[model samples]
Target: MSQYSILAAAVEHRLLEKNSEFITFLQPVSDREQALHWLQHYREHYKDAAHVCWAYIIGNTRQPQTQAFSDDGEPSGTAGKPMLHVLTERELGNCLAVVVRYFGGIKLGAGGLVRAYSAAVSQAAQQARLTLVSPQSLLRIAADFALEARIRQLLAQFDATLLDVQYQQGVALSVSLAAADLASFKLQLQELCAGAVSLTEPTA
Candidate 1:
């Protein structure tokens, strides 16, 4: 897909159920490394907690290459899986959710554990602000000085963001644009410069 929903910023929610303390942390993560870093950070920070369950979905939602969850000490399929289900049901991408639990003497059965974990994540997600992000790619274009103004104008028209510009033999401009717009942008560039401008394959 060209666009997906992602957390606007990090958020947290705390819930108390049957004397058990549950804290949920939600944050946007672009890759596996970022997700792991946050998970480790929380684990260390809450080392005394009874359980630290976590689930993350990284990479494209359509075909996620990195997706994992850990139930920690909680019964399998009770903590991590339910938390992941909450994230997946919301169609969230590139995000991580961690639920830290502090035992409250009394024990919640397996069903209760699932509900608690899922509820924690659901509450945090509800409070979180989400932003729609379109897939973007880097495009490098080389043109003569005469075409610089025209190139800039075209980029603005296409809603492309200029990343860098170099004045060498000619002008080398690096720009970022939605992946969906790449083909049309290339066509417009060719027509505008009468095929004089050189375009490079886009990089993610």
Candidate 2:
């Protein structure tokens, strides 16, 4: 199976109201550094907001660590936790949701806070969109000079990425193919080079 990480830029939106606040769901992100970086970037953007409550899920898909949220001064659990829940319910990973409260004067109780925060993340997520990512590996093939032309022709048949060619090293040819296509690619390379090409597979 292919492995991939999600990023914050994948989903983002802003909601603003004098009374309520704005909720922004960032794209999927991995690790603490990236998450903090995004937080600082947006925090500066909405520095004037009353409070910036946020949550994130960092860990594996099967067992995600809990979230971190704050009401900024609102009742606890009103803002951050709910925003995190929205991301969880959607089965999103490596994501962070930041709700910048502008303090609408009227106090939204815990329930009201939850509803608003949840709605913010959900709406942003809905607007953001989801995408699939895949892992790809590279396969290097070293072939005789006479066979390079045929190998290049065969490579064109598939979605292969060529890395480099070093004639100094006995017609060295490097190409990248999806990890899933490794077996088939090897078979095709063997046939194209008539057993004269050496193949190597490297994980990405």
Candidate 3:
């Protein structure tokens, strides 16, 4: 896993093209299931809309683990493809972009439809709040009760998240930290405890 950007929250943007209303919805998603949930929610909420075009990218943006798009009733390569291109070019992952169209008695040619959908998603993305997330791995450590406080301090120093603690026999801790930080964290812990702390496979 690698670092990537995802939407921090949902956002909405609207555009008008030759009287056609285009409503763009931008949302952060962890997987395909969450993306589909949002798509279905919007479809049911906006049942009367002319079309619902959507695209989603999960995992790494540069080389997404999963991706899909739907143009709904729009012409092939018009709505969904253009919207997906915008997301890919922006290097966004774990996110979904949906465009809802309300017909206004005008037809946008294939090229025009592509431009409209792409622009709608682009503008919405510009306004969306984003957060960069790094991949993490779990680790378990066992130390004497006397070293528990110092071990906790080391965990904080390394920015590791404490997941659990057990007091049986000695102090046992489970934590999660960025994979990049694991080596340094282990070295520091060894030095601090003088090799008294034992590292083990993550419990969870």
Error of 3 at 4 (Å): 2.2
Model 1 clash pairs? none
Best by lDDT: 3
Give the lDDT of residue 124 in candidate 2: 81
Model 1 score (lDDT): 0.90
User: Candidate 2, after superposition: displacement of residue 191 in Å?
Assistant: 2.5
| The best candidate in terms of TM-score | 1
lDDT of 2 by residue, 5-120 (tens): 44435666666543776757575677767777878887898888888888887643336644455566767777777777777777566777777777778777777777877887
Clashing pairs in 2: 6-28, 7-27, 7-28, 8-27, 15-22, 19-104, 29-94
* For every candidate, C-alpha RMSD to the true structure in Å: 1.8, 4.4, 2.1
Q: Candidate 3, TM-score vs. the true structure? A: 0.89
Query: How does each model score on lDDT?
Result: 0.90, 0.72, 0.91
lDDT of 1 by residue, 129-159 (tens): 8788887878999999999999999999999
What is the lDDT for 104 in model 1?
A: 95
Clashes in candidate 1: how many?
A: 0
